[model samples]
Structures are given as C-alpha cells and as structure tokens.
Target: MPTILLIEDEAALGMIVKDSLEMRGFTVQYAEDGEEGLRLFRAALPDIVVADVMMPRLDGFSLAERIRAENQTVPIIFLTARSQTADVVRGFELGGNDYLKKPFSMDELIVRIKALLGRQPAAPEAPAGPLPIGRYRFDYPKQRLHLDSHAADLSNREAELLKRLYDQRNQVLERTVVLRELWGDDSFFNGRSLDVFITRLRRHVKDDPQVQIINIRGIGYKLVV
Candidate 1:
C-alpha cells in the first residue's frame, strides 16, 4: 500500500481526513504541524504528502520546498483557504503537485490524491530542442510553447496535458480517460478545471488556425492538426 503523510493542525479535521484516507486503503501518518511533519517525512519517507499551508513551525510552502530539495518526484498536495490564491500558486511554485482549497469535500481530496498517484513517472529527457506541435514548438522540460518568435510558459499540469494530447494527436481522447489519467477523478470540479485548461491551451495555439483542440460535446476532445 502507498504511504501518505498528512499534516494538518486542526484536530478534528486531521482525524477525519486521516480516517477517510485510511478507509480508502492508504497508510497515513498524521502530524499537527510542519516541524513534526517534516520529521515524520524524514523518518517515514511516505509516497505522498498532504499538508495544510497555515501550520505552525514550518508552513506548507516551506515544508514542500524542503521536501523537494530532498526528493523531486514525491508528490505533495496543499490544503488551504479559498482566499489564499497566492499561497496556492506559491505552493505549486515550491514543487507541490496539487492543492485543495479549504471547505473541500473529502471525496474531492481522495480523487485528487488518487489522480496524482496515478501519474506515470516522467521519462528520461529527449535529446534536441523541443517537440513540434502543428505550428508551435513545445519544450516539455522547460514547460514552454513557442509560436514564431513569441513563447508562452505553461504550468506543470498544463504542460502535461498538452504532452498527452500531442502524443495522441489526431485521435479522439475521451474526457473520462483524460480526467482519470490526469486529475484522478472524473468529478464535476475536475471536469471544469479540464475545461479551463483546454481553453488556456486553445489560446496558446490560436496564432495558428491550423492547430486546434476540439471539444466533442458529451464525449471528450480531439487534437486536430
């Protein structure tokens, strides 16, 4: 079973989350703050880490940064309040894999966790410049897309989404398949997020009318080149 290290200061919420995750077959190590959480992280070396951003001693951003300094591939997810969009962005900037705003459902959290775990380990980097999309050049390692002389940087998740579609270019990729493979669940929220990402991607390639990520309503998406 995969081990998950959960760090949250709220006593009741902590227990509830831990119990919910355990019931879902994950081995969890609970901590009340970031200092102790970091210690446990070093000791247990869990497969994944779920932490709250407002903990005492070591905050979630710092904890995740520290963890990344030691291990780059171990997925880390942040839990924070809705207003802390800056913190959420910083958490991802610090190498966290995902984040859940406060007041989120346990089911949502579970599916996000499952989705991150389901990601295939990144493969060895390829030699040369960047992978070519219809009229754009996508540099996967750098998370950049170039159109003519202009370049747009994408978030890690966005880059991953683009890579998946590029790999299956000209194919109709099911919505659920993409959701399960990239977001862990095919829930409404994630589906909406997928829509946002799709829109962002569409804008990125809009300079070239030849490239399109078409939405096949009630079905999925098709990357047309």
Candidate 2:
C-alpha cells in the first residue's frame, strides 16, 4: 500500500480526501498547513505528496521546493484553485509532479494518481546510443534506466522527453517543439503538464554530477551534461 502525505488548509476537505484515499487502500498523513506538511515530510517520507498551494505559513510552492531539494525522486502533486498559466508553471518549476484543480472529483484524482504511478512506454528495438544520464544509464529502446544498483522504469512519454533532451544536450530545446513532438499541442495546460514531466526528468538525473536541465526563462530548456 502506498502512503500519501496530504497537505491542505481546509480541514474538512482534508478529512474527506484522507478518508477517500484510505478507502482506496492508501495510508495517509494529513497536515493543515505547509509548515506542518514539511515536518511530516521529513518525519515520514511518504511515497507521494498531495499539497494545497495556498496554505498559510510556508505555502505549497515553498514546501515542494524544500521537498525537492531534500528528496529528488519523491513525487509531489499540487492542489490549487488558481489555474493561471503562471501559477501552474511556477508549481512545475518548483518540482511538482502533477496538479489538480480545486473542486475536482475524487475519481479523477485517483485516476491521475494511477496514471502517474503506472505509466509505461513501450520498449525500443535498439538502444539510443551511449547516453549516460548522470549516474544512470538510459536504455531507451528497453525503457529501462539503471542507477547504481537500482533501476527505474520509464514511461513512453518520459523516455521520449529524455531522448529529446539528450539529443539537444547542452542547448535549449524549444518549448513549442517539445510540446508538439511529445504531446502534439502547445496549449497552456499542456505546457504546465510538460513542466511536471520536466521536474520528473530532473529528479531522475539529480544524482548525476554532470547532468542538469536548465530552464531558459521564457524560451525553453537546456540539458547540460
């Protein structure tokens, strides 16, 4: 069973979400503010985190940034009422793995979680050359990534995204090209979602001393190795 750390300012809604997730076989630790959320994160180190963006004290963005700095691979999902492109981009920039708009359905949230958790890309017939993502060896054809003694499975989307970055290593990969190639659209939501995936890719290579994905402000991203 997966343990979820839920950080939301609304007490009533928190309980509801906790109860709902528990019903779905997930253990949950609830925090009503970002400060408490950060404390719980350090103490428990839950599998996935769901946090509200507008909480008092620390705020979700700060909490996610701190969490990312501490743990590169732990997944974070932001829950926010604000749907502006800037806010969504900011959330992704802070290392958010996903986001849910306020007043969302529980079922949709569950599906999103399942998708994020279980997404897998079809393996390639041949490896994508000698690509070393930091300490990890990316076997793009097989959709497998190995780091140290551990291995991580990459979804098709993840692999494709990483492949593109590797192809454009050391320079900016245009945001529009990335979106059109990977997601087939350059809509605001797609852009926001791309940020989440970028965060994930960053986490995958965070341990590598020679690899980094640098955001090019309003333009695109540069993958330096």
Candidate 3:
C-alpha cells in the first residue's frame, strides 16, 4: 500500500480526505498547516503529497518548491480554490505534478492519486557526477553545484537545467524545446525566465575552466563539454 501525506487545514475536509484514502488501503498522514506538513514530510517521505493551496505558516506553492528542491520526482497535488491562469502557471512552475480545484470529488482525487503513483518508475540510483565542468563540478542526483570542494544548493529549475545540459553535453539544445519540455510553456515571459536561469547556471559554473554554457544567438544554447 502506498503512503500519502495530506496537508489541509480544514478539519472536516481533512478528515474526509484522510478517511477516504485510508479506506482505499493507503496509509495516510495528516497535517493541519504547511509548516507541520513540511516537518512531517521530511520525517516520513511519503509516496505522494496532497496539499491545500492556502494555509498558515507556509503556502502550498512554497511547500512544493521546497520538496522539489530535495526530490525532483516526488508527485505533488495542489488543492486550490482559485483557478486563475496565473495561479495554475505558478503551480506548474513550482513543480506541481497535479492540481485539484476546491469542491473536488473524493473519488476524483483518488483516481488522480493512483494515476500519479502509477506513472512514477522506481527511483533511479544517483548518477556519479561533479564530473568536472570548467571550474565547477555538479553532483547530479545530489543537485549540488561545487567549485572545487565548496558546494552550493541549486533551485529545482537550476538542477534540472544543469542535468539536461550535462546529459546532452556539447549538443545545442533548442530554446523553444527546452522551455516547452521543462517548463510546460514557451511564452515570452517563460522565455525570459529561462534566460534568467541560464544566467544563474553561468554564475555557478564560472569557476570551471572547461565547462561553458554558450548561447547560440538565434538558435539555442551549447553546453560545451
């Protein structure tokens, strides 16, 4: 049976969801606020997280961001009352795997949960890296950016981009292709956001003498091995 973490502040709704999941043979852990949810998450590391968007101490967006920083493959489902475009966009940007709007049916939630769990393959072993790139070394699965012996934590997007670049080392990755695949969008704002992330990557690898991320003018970026 899969374990699930349910983060919802409403007593009635929380109990209903928790009970429903439990009845379905899933082991469920409940948290009434974002802070406690995060604490519980770190301690237990459940198979999936179902979090409410609006909560005290910390919000769903921030919680999801934090989780993604640690485990990129963990599936997160956001429960939000607001269905605005910006809210949806932000959810995906924060690495949400699924979103459930307010007043959603319990059965629908269960179906979604099952689908997400099914999609996840067994966790892959951490790849050996910190493979010297220029002045920095990236420990891929560890998501650490290191200059010699010192290490820096990378944001989720940063880690994903770095991994992609390294995976296709020396290849020119198209800008549109990267944005659409990683970010789920290729709008002007998203394109600009990609540039910002690229700049950050450059900063991290600036110490490396051999590894360089070069912008190919009108085309894409070349991750020079």
Candidate 4:
C-alpha cells in the first residue's frame, strides 16, 4: 500500500478523501493546516501529496515551494476551488505535479493519483546533452539553461515541455498529444491551462529570435529554431 499526505482544511472533505484512499489500500495521514502538513510531509516523505490551496498558517503554494526546494522528485496534487488562470499557473510554478479544481469527483482524484504514481518509471533521468535553442543552451544533466551568460531556473514542467519540443524539433506537435503526454488528459479546460504554460515559455525565450512556437490552425504547436 502507498502512503499519502492529505492536507485539507475542510474536515468533511478531508475525512472523505482519507476514507476513500484508505479503502483503496493506501495509508493516509491527514493535516488540517499548512504548518503541520509540511512537518508531516518532511517526517514521513510519503509517496504522494494531496493539498488544498487555501489554508491557515501557510498557503499551499508556500508549502509546496518549501518541499520542492528540498525534494524535487516527490509528486504533488493541488486542490483548489478557484478556476482563475493565475491560480492554476501559480500552482504549477510551485511544482505541483497535478491539479484538481474544487467540486471534483472522488473518482477523478483517485484516477489522478494512480496515474501520477504509475508514470514514475517513465520519468527516467533526462538525457545528457546540450539542448540548443537559438543562442540559449540547456544542459539537461545539470538541469540548467544558459542565455547570454545568464542562467535561468526552469521549473519541472518547463524543463519537461522544453525537452519534448526539442525532441520533436521542426515537427508539428499535436495539441492533444502534448496535453495527454504532459497533463494526462486533453479536456478543453486543460487545453486552456496548457496555453498559459505555453505563454510563459514564450516569455522566457523572448530574447531568442530564432526560437519560435508556431500555432497551427486547429492543430497544435511547432517549436522551430
């Protein structure tokens, strides 16, 4: 059985998630606030985490940032009621492995947790190479990207996206394919969410004129250099 740290302030929802996960053969430790959640998270270092965005003592984003600073590989799933684009983007920026908006079904949460844990094997160490995008260089082994003598910190999702695009350079990456590969599903909502990340990447590489993210009509995006 896998272990899960569930950080949720709502007593009813926390209990429901706890019971549901335990019934599925998982050992769950519940935390009602961010501080205790972080303490338990470090002590137990569970296989996965399910956290709510809003909490007393500390918000989900701060807790997640702290965890990511220490453990970059642990899986995290964020729970939030707000559907705003900024909220979603911030969650991903803070190293959330996945996101489930509020009012989500229990079944969906279970499926997401299973999918994340199942994909662990596929996320092998990134290949060793100097990934060149225009004048910028991405050293995958070192997890560093250099641009004009300056280094930029690429988040996990950013690194993943960059790797995929670089792997399929000069090729048309179907929107659905990228979504399923990166986000697990290609729902319209997720599509829009993906667009936000794409936008952020565009901003990150704005200095490189040769780096282009072309949007194909009703199709997908192509990263051309």
Best by TM-score: 4
TM-score for candidate 4: 0.73
lDDT of 2 at 213: 94
- lDDT, candidate 1, 121-144, per-residue tens: 442334377888887999987778
Two-way lDDT contest, 1 vs 3, winner: 1
User: Candidate 2 on 17-79: residue-level lDDT in tens?
Assistant: 999999999889999999999999999988788999999999999998898778756777889
How does each model score on lDDT? Answer: 0.81, 0.80, 0.79, 0.81
lDDT of 3 by residue, 1-225 (tens): 899999999989999999988988999999999999999999999989999999999999999988878876677889989877678767866767666789999877886677556432322335754666666777766668887669887754577677777767898888887776555457664576577678778877777657789999978888996
Record all residue pairs in model 3 with backbone atoms less than 3 Å apart, i.e. clashing.
Answer: 130-138, 134-208, 134-209, 134-210, 134-211, 135-207, 135-208, 135-209
Q: lDDT of model 3 at residue 70?
A: 86
Off by over 4 Å in 4: 118-163, 199-218
Which residue runs does candidate 1 get wrong by more than 4 Å?
119-181, 184-225
Candidate 2 structure, TM-score to reference? 0.65
Of the two candidates 1 and 4, the one with more favorable TM-score, higher being better, is 4
Q: What TM-score does prediction 3 earn?
A: 0.57
* Cα TM-score per model: 0.61, 0.65, 0.57, 0.73
Model 2: pairs clashing at backbone N, Cα or C within 3 Å: 121-155, 121-156, 124-141
Better of 2 and 3 by lDDT: 2
